[model samples]
Target: MKSEFYCWLANKLPRGLAYWCAIRVMSHAACANPAQEVDTLTPAQCLKAWPK
Candidate 1:
């Protein structure tokens, strides 16, 4: 339901503007949920943690 509304709204927007809006929304959500555990890792980090 929410995704449907988002898709409809995004389609109504210009392509680039829709992408920018999505990025901004995601950034805001990440900031708002600082305490959330995010195990995001760089390629180097991932390799270092990989099992032998």
Candidate 2:
């Protein structure tokens, strides 16, 4: 992602410590939802399984 995007996200978070917290939160969400095969889970199930 671009630094400008990061900067924008950082600013959108509550000022101060919340900025770092937001980064951590985003990282955790990404880690929890690592990319995978959409077909493996079946079509109806895949929507719930994958991140938006």
Candidate 3:
């Protein structure tokens, strides 16, 4: 759900901005404690699980 939104948002953004946004988002997600089941994921895991 969130990943979908992120991807959509990233697609709409400029390439450099999208990369920066993704890195920032992933960094925050990596540091934060899991709230939902999906939130428990590591950055690598999240990337893998993200829709391609």
Candidate 4:
């Protein structure tokens, strides 16, 4: 539900801006400690499921 809501909100934003932001957030996550385990898929992964 939260992801759906956020996606709906993101649809209100410019496509270029949204894509740029997603890339930045994913890059930031990639920079996180490699040893750390993510309990769930990151937002970037979820965003990937969306159609461009």
The most accurate candidate by lDDT is: 4
CA RMSD, predictions in order = 11.6, 10.2, 8.2, 8.1
lDDT of prediction 4:
0.66
Provide the overall lDDT of each model, using Cα atoms, as 2-decimal numbers.
0.58, 0.56, 0.66, 0.66
Query: What's each prediction's TM-score?
Result: 0.47, 0.38, 0.41, 0.49
**Can you list the residue pairs that collide in candidate 4?**
none
lDDT for each residue of candidate 2 in 1-52, tens digit (9 for 90 to 100): 6989988976787676876664555555555556744234333443344466
Off by over 4 Å in 4: 1-5, 34-52
Q: Clash number for every model?
A: 0, 0, 0, 0
Which stretches in model 3 have alpha-carbon errors above 4 Å?
1-9, 34-52
Higher lDDT: candidate 2 or 4?
4
Q: Candidate 4 residues 1-52, lDDT tens each?
A: 9999988998899989988987766655555634544445477664564446
Candidate 1 lDDT by residue in tens digits, 1-52: 9999977887899989878865555555455456643344333443343445
In candidate 2, position 38 carries an lDDT of 29
Which residue pairs come into collision in candidate 2? Answer: none
**Best candidate, TM-score:** 4
Residues 1-52, model 3: lDDT tens digits: 9999977876788888878867766655554535635456666765654446
